[model samples]
Target: MNEFPRMSVRDTFARDWYLFRLDLLLAGMPNKKVAEIRKDLRIELAQAAQDGEFRQALAGLGPVNVLASNYLEAHGRKVPRVWAGLVAFAVLLYGWLLGVISLIEGLYSAADQIRPDATVEVVRNWLFVQARVVAGPEGVDSIGFSLSGWGLLGWLAVLVIVPLICASVWRAWLPRPTADQAQRA
Candidate 1:
């Protein structure tokens, strides 16, 4: 019989603990059960180390340990898919809200220009004056004033609604882990 060389106590224990965690995750064990398994595995590995049989035990367990690790890795990829969907939803919703605000502002501007009391030049001058008043000279040449009633409303709506949406979605998607799960991790 070909015998494998002995692994050190620390190395054997570390490998066994890592494999045990992977096995628990792959087995879809409940959080409490996983914690229990981990405790038991630690005790067993410690005893095996004292008995000088740690490497022998690990060699026997190696194939199943590798399989469990692979399985857990495969399942882990699904978490990123959920996160990606959340980010895409947030970006699209923000863009849609901004588009609505822009459309309303454009309509209001057009109506202001068409009023009986206003000429095109008068409306243009009024806009320039308002922009300068809000932004001062420095911003006049940049993006102009963004502190209009519509702009304020848009900013307030985004600030209020985005956090509420995110909080609600997070609660629905990810409930708090149980104490046992937290302990295991």
Candidate 2:
């Protein structure tokens, strides 16, 4: 019974700390920034535990939600809202574009699996039947279709550039400071 209670308390302490860490993350601070805050907390907790004041330390940290809000209030404003929003939008758009590409590739794979012997004529005819082009306001007077190497290259360039641009923006908005800078601070 004594051992069971001790184990329970230990588990609760760990669980609480994990919840605190996640709450910090939920405050919209970047992962690296949250980790830095959590690291300091863990150090404090360890010191308290060494002094047999673990429970006191936990109480001192206060409610996880409140602590997170305070943390965001203090540190989250380093990045401007417009820049952060733009970075988030770019990331989401990049993800959506990747999903669209994946879906198209999956469909093409399935089609290939279904008809391995399909010729260019079959694929072209299928495209002609499915794809519709409208030239005027409502409908096109005529439909013409062409697939070229340059078109494929253009798509590939977009696929590569979109993610690169998003990554650059994300980094700019939430830069992971170097170890030297962190330590100096």
Candidate 3:
């Protein structure tokens, strides 16, 4: 006959405790509160018998879906606002990065138009024409590129700085987490 090692009462409790905590989190119980509640439950479970009694006690907590539903329905408003801000930030960042990439691509396209066979004067004249069409009558000024490095640097700064600024603003606009939400963190 083969013998298998029996699971300890503590081990059984630990496994059930972990599963319960996960269900609570998925149900929207904040992290801090979940830990506290779990601690209290562990003490209760330890006092109970390790056989059917412990299992029954765990089942009495109710189903996982009910726990999650209760938390989300109570905090639905705050959750949607957080999700909206995150989505807005994502959209803005994507648009900004796309604009920057398009600008770089346009510059490359103009450079490619210049052939090795073309004379310097011809190249300069062709570029002048292309710039006027692409950058408007103001040419380089319209495209924000000057002989000095400031044009590229300034736009780069805008690209990097804007997202951070918007993110800070979004965070500030959010409602403070409630006692319940904080527990669910």
Candidates in order have lDDT scores of 0.50, 0.53, 0.49
What candidate 3 gets wrong by more than 4 Å, as runs, is: 1-70, 76-80, 116-185
Clashing residue pairs for model 2: none
Which lDDT tens digits does candidate 2 get at residues 1-185? 32122324674567466666655445445567777877677667766766777778778878776676666556533433334445555675577556555544544544444443323212222211222222332222333344346655655565566556664676576755567645433
Tens digit of lDDT per residue, candidate 1, span 1-185?
A: 42344557687667766765565444433456556656666566556666777767556556655645553344331122233345656785667656655544554455444554322222222211233111222222122223467656765576566665764565467545567644544
List model 3 lDDT by residue over 1-185, tens digit each. Answer: 42323446675865576566544344333556556656666666555544536666666756755654555556532332333445555775577566555655566456445433432221121111222113322232223222225655655565556566765565567677778855545
Clashing pairs in 3: 27-68, 29-184, 30-183, 30-184, 30-185, 31-184, 31-185
Models 1 onward score TM values of 0.29, 0.35, 0.35
User: Which has the higher lDDT value, candidate number 2 or candidate number 3?
Assistant: 2
Candidate 3, lDDT over the whole model? 0.49
Clash totals for all models, in order? 0, 0, 7
